[model samples]
Target: MKQCWLDIRAAEGLKSVLCQEAIHRGFDAIVADDPADLAGLPPTVSRVLLPGKELPDAFGDADLVIVDPVQHGEPGRLAARHPGVRFGAHVDVTDADSLAVACASVTRDPVTVLRFADPTNIPLEIVLAAAADAHGLIVTTVERAADAPVFLGVLEHGPDGVMLAPSAPGEAGRLKDAVERRSPDLELTELTVTAITHAGMGERACVDTCTYLARDEGILVGSRAKALVLCVSETHPLPYMPTRPFRVNAGAIMSYTLADGEHTRYLSELRAGGTVLAVGADGRSRPVVVGRVKIETRPLLSIDAVAEGGEAVNVIVQDDWHVRILGPGGAVLNSTALQPGDRILGYLPRRERHVGYPIDELCYEQ
Candidate 1:
């Protein structure tokens, strides 16, 4: 997980409320310009003091003090003079010389706070690459809490932490959430096919995503929210058509597909710029952007499957040999060829859904 630091320097009257909320949200550190502002803060959060160019004579209860080596003294010498407090180097990267200095500080300083003058992430990417093997923490300052995700994803490894000077209340919590957002793997089950029938003409959805999906990757779709079948992507070879590596012939327009781990959305509700979970055969899942959803009238087939616990699941899709679902050990089974007693990969959600949000209540679907 990435570390989140709250900068309360310009919070004015809302400083106390922001600090309390930051601590409640388990923020890694609270940054302030005045030493007095760092006092009375709980030890649960690291107190980071970022003073002006001229260093203060006395340090209070600050856990870490960020300073410019050129303005104040060297970080090591400052640490020696103020043994009770830890020292970190701050750098403003505006040009090649400043970028080099920031890169050097990342390796030598125990903690390096960087402010990039350019809007582009090139400078920070260079610093991150330079600190690939460095043991220190690299905290990059962002203009807003919303920009934390972009910086946290730089070079894939990203910076060790991000510092945000929130403009208003509750921004710290938002920043914390952005820093800790992650997709978890699901436990897929092997469901046995119980029945199959021709459901006549209906609209089915073809989920086109912005990213190319792997052969083992696809989306989960079902008539009922409690149970869903793994629908494979169009990454495999088709006899008459070129491969559509970014498309998944999902299911009927009204079927439920996962928007994330905790939420589901109907295929009809999916639109361009929306997100859906792209799950792999091994149960790993990631969010992929929806480029578009193609809905067309076609002869539909209904598939009925049962989980290990005897839970019934249904998925309706276009009745064609080209449409496919996944089986155990990454086996691809054509939807038209499914038979009774055939085993396919599926997932059983614990609770029923209401408006896409999981809710613990009695709900039934056929």
Candidate 2:
């Protein structure tokens, strides 16, 4: 399980509120400038001291110590000098060299506190790289609640913990919830092609997600509620047109999409600012914001498929060669060359959903 900490050293007026909330949320510890500041804290919650001038004489009583490598030398040496004392080096995320040093220092000390003072200029890629580099604990401090998911979702395995400050009230709980949520992963099964037909001209939905998608990543859409087909995005380079790595020419407007595994939404209902899951060929998924949804009248091709379990599904997509699907062994198959009996990757919902959440109820969609 991931860990979380609360920094209340500089919290003047909101110190008590933040400390109590941190205890309520089961944080690992509360970091303060002086150990006396955490006197009233619950016994279950550990206390961490950020010694300024010098090491405290009661260091053995404190659970953790945070220090700066530049001012106090290496944290590992400090820990070695004072036996039984655990120390964590404080690092600024903006400094590349400092970030690298901090990540490397994790080999000597098991914990590193990565601080991000500038919320507007939070370097997400650097933070992710640092987190990947650290073999031990990588704790971060963000300025806002919105930045929580970014740090928690950037890599397959994100940071081990985060330090919530008192700057944002009532945000620690929400940040904890976001970090605790499991990363998205898709379960794809084989669907045999049943039929392909020309469905004349219709409005097709071209979903442009906020994140840049890879060639193997796309959206899942189909006609049936239980079964859905993986529609590869427009990231593949074509002889006729340039690649749009951020766009997925999903399907006809009425087609159903597996928005976030539990919930299904119509392709036509998708609009800017809506959320969608970008699925890769390996079945791993990540949430993406809808940047734009383009609807255009174009010739359509209807694809019918059925699984071995007797489940049948269909989708009408733009009759263009650029639109593709994932076949057996993760091979890319163009829609224009699809034939009967060709196996393609698809998904089956475990249970029905209501308003984007799972519920124990019967529901159907045509």
Best by lDDT: 1
lDDT tens digits, residues 27-94, model 2?
Answer: 78888988788676767987888878676777634777888887887888888898888887887656
TM-score of each: 0.90, 0.76
**Candidate 2 weakest ten by summed lDDT:** 117-126
TM-score result, candidate 2? 0.76
Error of 2 at 186 (Å): 2.3
Question: How close to the true structure is residue 141 of candidate 2, measured as C-alpha lDDT?
Answer: 80
| C-alpha root-mean-square deviation, candidate 1 | 2.4
lDDT of 1 at 23: 92
Q: Candidate 1: misplaced stretches above 4 Å?
A: 73-85, 360-362
Q: CA shift at 242, candidate 1, in angstroms?
A: 3.8
What tens digits encode model 1's per-residue C-alpha lDDT throughout 1-366?
788898998999989999999999999999998999999999999999999977888778888999997778668889998767799999989999989888888888899999999899999889998998899999999888789989988997789899988888888888888888888899999999999999999899999999999999999999999899999999999999998999999999999999988899999999899999999999999999999999999999999999989899999999999999999999999999999999999998879899999998888787
The Cα local distance difference test for each model comes to 0.92, 0.79
